[model samples]
Target: MGKILVIADQKDSAIATGRGLELAARLGYSVDVYAFVYAPLGRLKQTAAERNALKQRLLEDREAEVQARIDKLSREGQKVKLKVVWQKDVAPWVVGHCGKTAYEMVVKTGRRSESIANTSTDWQLLRECPAPVLIVAKKKWRRTQPVMAALDLSSRIAAKKQLNATILSQAIALAEAMDEQLHIICAVEVPTLLEDLDLIDSRSYVAEAKQAMAPHIKALARQFDLPLKAFVVKRGPVEKVITSQAASMRAQMVVMGTVGRKGVRAKLIGNTAERVLGQLKTDVLALKP
Candidate 1:
């Protein structure tokens, strides 16, 4: 596996750096922190000297946080590095940098608020990040338990499948590294309209989905040579199915992909992958294609 790149916000909560460092230590992977500094509003309208001072201060603050996090990781036997980047569009810049770097995974903290109106930096990072990204929220990080990889069988997007496979691969690798179990779950959504029409014979659909997923799951299991379990759920909404299953299985982390759809297309039709990210309490590893 390549190095893990953490795109950290200098102004947001320090949880981003803390989570990244913790994961790096647990997984035995080196960490490269890209600390981003947004241009100050006053500096945007200030004199050259004043703007320069503001920029210097921002850099200094960011550097201090980065160094502190790096030291913490070092105490845990992790090799850590820091890079300070001054960019207005930190999301795209981080994505482009990850594309060029030898990084297999990217970690960042989740948006502060879940309300739709309150769009945080982590939300933007989730939407645009290229690598398989982990959004750490305010909770105890589960490091030594099974990681859940949630698979949505409804969407037939090719990119989504590829991204899901990437997440599964990462989870399996992490589980192996940590000597933990890995669970692969495909959440099957039974349409309410079908239920209303008394056509909700979900067994066939569940069986078919399980059959289709069998080869992939077996191949992964064989590749990893680890204990793997697969589950096909045929009830409730995608988010509920995933969360309930993960909770039942006592999973430490949930890994899945983000389907890049928006507006009415995202709402009326909806994307289970995105909804699962929003609803789940487990640490999520969301991949963007």
Candidate 2:
């Protein structure tokens, strides 16, 4: 694995450094902490212009606070090198910076009070960044906790197969690194259109979905050397089923995937990944293929 780009958003919420650092240590990935200051200088146009020294002092103070947070985490015996970058316009900057390096993953605190109309920087990065993203939760978890991997066997796109594999592989690796159990789940829900289309049977579709996912689940189990019991198949909208599965299993983290590049229905429909994220209270490791 390469270095991980950690977006330290102290302003949004307390940086969940423990989970991020633990993940980096397990993956053996160096951490580059990017702490962006959102507060404009002096918070007033006239004050910023007249009180240049005061503005400078404020900027320095803000940077110091962020640096202090990073320093505190770095000292806790994490075997990862840590570096920091401070700037403004954090989200767009981070998205652009992703193209400059081959970072294995981008870790950040999940956006606060997020909604369709009010999406946050983390959501933007999840949609745009080239690297995989790990949205750490405010609630901390033990170093070793169960993780659930969400699988969608009904995707028609050829690339979805690659995405599923990437999701499972990372989840498996993390489970091994932390000495935690990895649960694989396939959530199937018949779409509303299924009833409208001719020759479409909801019950039969559910059965076929399970049948289709069986081989892939079995293959992943063998590859990861996981027991058959680790795999599960659920029926419901992913927003409900994925979270329900994770909660039931007491998973501290969930590894899933999103479509990075836009597609035909991308504009018309909200990302299912976002819906799942909204429902879960645990940390999420998102990947793109």
Candidate 3:
């Protein structure tokens, strides 16, 4: 199996690393822990060489500290590697590394901001990282909890269709590996503006939306060999419905896809994955189409 890349933060608690190690141990994959560290800037009068020396010392210290923690937390007989890079921001480095390395997945702790307008490192990685990114939460996985896969069945776009398949495929693999149940979640988005203007009836619109999503949902369940009872179709905002269902079901993780929006488009439209992630208390496995 390929290695799983776990991004370590400067925080005392290595939540991502621990979760990644557990996942790796379960899936039989090795782990590569990358700890990005930075030293305080030297005084303006300080020589360049002195500043460089300080940075190197800081990197070495962080390396040792991370290594000790990894040694303590890593599973026995697991092939885990550690690399401490002297960089404060990790998104760029991790995105570049994923391009060069054949990691099965990239695991990182979700650093969410209060507002979706403000982007976090997880948002950056979700957009640019080539490999599948798993943003773990504070809550650990429970064996009985289901692994929920979110799909946009209303979208007829080829990319969305492909992404739905990818999301289900990953979720199925995870559920099987962890011996957990697999659940499917799709939100029926009713147009609020049209309904408000009396252009469309709210109840009829909801019925039509659910009806439109039926065949696709059935095909997916058959394709994945999942029972119909495991599927959840709800009406509301995508973010609200997914988060609510995950909470209600006590999902271990929610697997979904992001189109990898960038720049102004990302900020303006606000990626669904980003918004849902802001509210999710469970782990998320985000894939790119």
lDDT of model 2 at residue 277? 73
Error of 1 at 262 (Å): 4.4
lDDT of 1 by residue, 119-218 (tens): 4555555665667778776664354368777765555687766766677777777777767777777765667798678785677766776677677666
Per-residue lDDT tens digits for candidate 3, residues 1-289, read 7799999856588888888998899889999999988756755568899888888888889888888889889978999998888776788989998999888899998877735466688999999999999998865436428889999898989888989988999899888898998888888877889878899888888898888888888888899887878778889988899999988888989999888999988888878888888788888888988
Model 1: residue 113 alpha-carbon error in angstroms:
3.9
**Alpha-carbon lDDT, every model:** 0.69, 0.74, 0.86
Candidate 2: tens digits of C-alpha lDDT, residues 50-128: 7677556666776677666666666466545434444666767888888888888888887634643555777778788
List where candidate 3 sits over 4 angstroms from the true fold: 40-49, 114-118, 139-144
Q: What TM-score would candidate 3 get against the native?
A: 0.92
- TM-score of each prediction: 0.80, 0.84, 0.92
Worst 10 residues of 2 by lDDT: 259-268
Winner by TM-score between candidate 3 and candidate 2: 3
Query: Which pairs clash (backbone N, Cα, C closer than 3 Å) in model 2?
Result: none
Ten consecutive residues with minimal summed lDDT in candidate 3?
136-145
Best by lDDT: 3
lDDT at 151, model 2: 79
Q: Judging by TM-score, tell me the better candidate of 1 and 2.
A: 2
* Greater-lDDT candidate between 1 and 2: 2
lDDT of 2: 0.74
